[model samples]
Target: MNIRTAAVRILNSYHHQYFNYENKIAATSDGLKLSGKDRDFLYILVKGVILHRSYLDFVIEIAAQRSVKKFENTVLNLLRVGVFQYLILETPPHAFTNETVDAARQLKKPRAIGLINAVLRHLLLKDELKTRLAELPDNESLAIQFSHPQWMIDRWIEHFGIANTQIIADFNNSYQKIYFRHNPVKISWDDLSQILKDSGYTISVAIDSPILFFSTDTPGELIRSELFNKGFMSVQDISQSLAVRLLNPQPGEVIIDACAAPGGKTGMIAQLGGRESIVNAYDISPAKVQLLKNEAFRLGLDFVNYGVADARSGTFPMADKVLLDVPCSGTGVMARRADLRWNRTPQDLETLLVMQREILTNMVNAVKPGGVVIYSTCSIEPEENWQNIEWFLEANPDFTIESADNFVEAKWCDKNGAVQVLPHLHNETGGFAVRLQRR
Candidate 1:
């Protein structure tokens, strides 16, 4: 199949099976034996459609003069891909229209061929599309412009105000950089940097971290290289690494990663704390726990003990530090995970809050007296970050918020002393972490 057909199939899998777009893209790319350029084009088409879905749908409805809901899933996706090419990628009108129509025929959606051509032609004929989009009310306009859910835009406006909300939306729509955390246990920062530089990868360190580095060059080669497979480096965002930095695990301390899976933090803890520290990591999924175990082995961090257990309820060994990097709405990394904005709902936030609280409450008992429990999430929503910590503190008076200033730079922390990394402000993925100490 052609790259465009493969892009449509990946999108279909994401829509029908609710699978992650990244995973679906990877699997489809490999199955098709796509060349580098073909794979990149496929990625652009799928990711572009996902990132600008709302705007594309709006354009489709306007040009077709019918709601998008009436189109079959196949036809709808075909139109989205076509419109993305014409509008965002700015592929020439004739080229994109003809190619998209051909893709529909290739995918055996012959019925959509005429419709696709007609709508795309209609879109070309309409010079007032941009004007109409701009004329929408503020929230509606921002939602379509940024391809975010309107409710999400409303929530951000309520919490961060209109100006910051626009900034956040714009940031989320920008290109997300890939970051990798070097394993100090196996390689020093200088050695890794020199090696990567000698290999022609332009690498830069994160603002406050030496071990965390990012490259403007595509990470495909690095990720597939022996350096990553040998566990000299692991993919992790600087924002996510902040929680581990705040924990500051000591040589003899017992560290518990309550929701560790695909164990980046767990490995970091073991690396920072040395082999003497016992790191116990647990997650609800057995497959994920195995992934954590495999990662530990790859990193040569044999001291980490892995278990498959629910964090919301289960016995955990008492430890000097516990990291509860709970599941969240993932608002912070939307730029990286393009499909997340579409998959999440306000109700999902409500449900996640309850689950986050239960896990936090349960993990509190796992920390020894005077020990710390770092509550964190990759969400920018106030309700999921500080508000949850507030609720936890009010319910459990024995625990008190410790200023993150002692650990991270003051710039990343809010007035309340919690680490609040805003994507717009920090130019990093948004994340939150509060160090809570038990009295």
Candidate 2:
């Protein structure tokens, strides 16, 4: 399939809010039988437009002499894809113009052909796509230049300061290297390293982390190999692995993984908790529970058990250690989930804050008096991390913050015994994990 058709299908799915953006893209690609290169280009076009929709529209309004809101959804998306290719990809001027026009005709958008051509002609004459967008105000510049929401940029500026916020914004706008953790229970790092190397994979060890990273090109080869099927390696961000490290599950200890889905942390718990340790994992989704069961079987985690259960609704069995990786705003993982910046809204943060409080309270209740509770989220929002911890501590005087520096690197832990991994500073997914002990 051509990039234009695939991008349009993805945009239609995204605009309708019918299904997940990335999942829809994968399904569309598979349905169209796209080649590897065409699939990559389709992803680039779709994500590039979504990631930079605001900025692209700002440029489009300048060239079209009208607000993009006035155009129909199909025309607007076509313009976005066309402008993204012409300006950002820097495709040959004439070739891109002709290709986009042909795409519109092929899609049976004859009524929009003249308007598309006129806009492209005007954009070519204006030549503003290459200009440095420096003249605008700080808020406007950050929004249009980086294609992020103004409210989010302002919040980051307040939290990280002006210069560092820009650095983080730029990082979120780019692709991050894929990180993987070698399953120590299945295979040692040295052994896995040699195996991957022999399989024509380029591998590098992460600094200050036991994790490994490799080129993204060979994922197809790795996914189909015995290493993945047998769970010799697990794909996760280094910051996420820190949660399992901080939990420090000991031999024969009982661990409860609340809200566990896809079972990365649950598997890590089984590995770290020793062969005799017991791990009970729970998720709200029945489908996710099945996935957890599959992961456990693949990794040979005999001690780990999983079921579908909601953490907020009922009491859970008391355990020596509990991990509550609660869902949050996902501000920390924008690099990998490119469309997240557009999907999130302030209202969603409000809903998540309520859910996080409930889940943390329940998990804390489930842990034994002296046992540890690890509260974590893949979010940089203070309301979801430190502030939530503060609220929990204030409400429950029996629990106190445990120094996380004992397990994670001192640099990743704050003075309050919380780990806040910033993407710009750490060059990984943004994350926050704090350990609490019930007195």
Candidate 3:
């Protein structure tokens, strides 16, 4: 399939997922057939529009002098894709407009093609688009400029101040890094590096951890490689790897990963703990539990056991350590998960706060006295990060905060003893983790 048609198909898939509450990644993977460069272009067009949807719509509103809702959904999404390409991708206006107009005809909206062409042309004729972006007010402009919900931006400003919020917005609007963890158990880092290099893959060290490696190869190619099939490498984000490092699981100890799914960290624990330690990994979803089991089997991490149970309600035997990697608003990793900025709302944050509190409380009880409980989330929001830790500390007198910097880098941790990995600061996906010891 051509890039434009593939983009449109993926955009329609995003529309269905957006309206029906579906997974955008799963939808894109299932719907699009383009591969390699074409697939990359399709991803750029589709995710760029979604990440900058409001911004693209704002440009259209400025050029067309009307609300975007006035157009049919297909036409609107087509316009969004066009505007994103022209304004953000900085594609040549004539080529972008004409190509979009041609693609618009595929939507069977022949009558709307002229409007799409005219509006995009008008935007093109305007001298340098950046000049127009400078004209709007602060909050309203940022809401559209960054394509983030206004309330989220406001909340970030309240917690992080104006400059940091803008930095965060910039981070969220950009493409994210792809990091892979080499399984030292199956193959040494030197061997993995040689294999990836020989396979025409470029490697870089973005973090201090030797297990983590950054690559230029697409995730699809990496997953299908012999190394991946033989369980020598696994796709994981650096922020998550950092969390596992902070957990500091030791050999011969028992660790319970309360929210383990797909089992990235479970494998990490088992690998790091050598052959002596045991990991009882559980997730609320049985399907996800099965995925963890499969991952464990593939990685040859038999030390990592799996079960399906809700951490908030299920009772489990006490362990030397417990990892409560709870769900959150996922604001920190927006650069990778583009639709999350649109899908998350203020109410969702509030709901997640309650769930985080409940899960933390339950998981803390499962850890033995003097044992560690590492609470983690892929969220930059304080309400879900340090704020939740504060609440947990106040409620659970027996648990005291540990210096997260000691585990990772002291620079990432705040005075409250929790680490907040800001994407703008780290130049990677954002995440948060705080270690606590039971008194």
Scored by TM-score, the top model is 1
TM of each candidate vs. truth? 0.94, 0.91, 0.92
Q: Model 1: per-residue lDDT, tens digit, 1-439?
A: 8677888877777664267777777788888888766777888889889899999999999989999999988889989999998988889999998888888989999988888888999987656787897788988898888899999999999988888888999888877778787788888878888988887888776653534656547677688677789888888888888898889888999999989987888888888889889889999999899889888889888878888889999998899999999999999988888888989988999999999999998888899999999999999988999889888989999988889999988888999988999977898899999999999
Query: What are the lDDT scores of the predictions, listed in order?
Result: 0.87, 0.82, 0.80
Model 1 regions more than 4 Å off = 207-210
| Tens digits of per-residue lDDT for model 3, 253-322 | 9999999986888888888887898879999999898889888878888767788899988898799999
Q: Which candidate is the best by lDDT?
A: 1
**Cα lDDT tens digits for candidate 2, 1-439:** 3578568757866753334676776777788887766766787788788888888898888888899889987788888888888878898778777877777877788899899988988777544654535667787788787888888999889888888888888888876776666677777778888888887887666643434434445564466577788888777777887888899988888899998997888887887777888889999999999989888888878768877788987678989999999988889998878778887888999999999998987777788979999999999988999999999999999998889998888989878888889987887789999999998
Question: Order of all candidates by TM-score, from best down to worst?
Answer: 1, 3, 2
The deviation in Å at residue 295 for candidate 3 is: 2.2
Q: What is the lDDT of residue 220 in candidate 1?
A: 70
Residue pairs in collision within model 3 = none
For residue 90, what is the lDDT in candidate 2? 90
Q: Give me candidate 2's TM-score against the actual structure.
A: 0.91
Better of 1 and 3 by TM-score: 1
Which residue window of length 10 is worst by lDDT in model 3?
Answer: 16-25
